[model samples]
Target: MIFVETQYDQTPAALNDLVENAALAALKHQSAPENATVTIVLTDDEQMHSLNLDYLGVDAPTDVLSFPSEEIDPETGDPYLGDILISVPRAANQAESTGHDVESEAQLLTVHGILHLMGHDHAEPEEKERMWQAQAEILTKLGLGNIQVRES
Candidate 1:
């Protein structure tokens, strides 16, 4: 299951669908289990700043953050992938700078976060190449081939 919670009041209604589709695309690309579940949280910069500081020791706000979990829900027996938090304001800014709409940027971030939850990382050169390639392929499948993820 894919769950989305919007803590930001200004988020558009269509954003929820975008996030869900992006997540599903990423999961399908990764060949995740059919019963896997994940949550996506759309929030503001203030909450993102606090989360970044508390969890990653980074004092600055970020566009997206993913916390991976490998737990199974006892009741449903679904694999809980984890939670993804995205700053709506940050995504808007990034979208403005990248010459795309907020919807596309949010979807990009969604895909990026799901990739992370699926154990894709860019800490090393080779890892980054692989992850980026996978991300691009997923984005293309989502009809966002022209939307490039900005370097952070």
Candidate 2:
């Protein structure tokens, strides 16, 4: 199951569909278990900054943050991949500069976060290439082939 929560007051309802489709596409591309679950939370820069500072020791807000989990949910016995938190405001800002809609930016962030939960990291040159390729493939499959996540 894919779950999405929007904490921002101005977040559009359509954002949920974009997030859900992106999450599902990434999971399908990875051949994740049918019982696997992924949760997405959309918020503002303030919440993202707080989470980044508290968990990652960073003082700035990022586009997305993933908390991976390999264990099954005790009550449901379903494999819970993890939680993906996105800053809607951040996504909007990125979309503005990237010449894409916020929905597409949200989808890109969703794919990026799901890749992280699936153990893909871009800390090195080769790893970045591999991860970016995977992102391209997944986005293409989702019909957003032209969308690219800007390097930071």
Which candidate wins on TM-score? Answer: 1
TM-score of each predicted structure versus truth: 0.98, 0.96
User: What digit string (tens of lDDT, one per residue) describes model 1 on residues 28-145?
Assistant: 9999998999999999999999999999999999999999999999999899999999999999999999899999999999999999999999898898998899999999999999
lDDT of 2 by residue, 13-88 (tens): 7999989999999999988898999999999999999999999999999989999999888998999999999999
Give the RMSD in angstroms, all C-alphas superposed, for model 1.
Answer: 0.7
C-alpha RMSD of candidate 2 = 1.0
Best model per lDDT: 1
The parts of candidate 1 lying over 4 Å away from their true place are: none
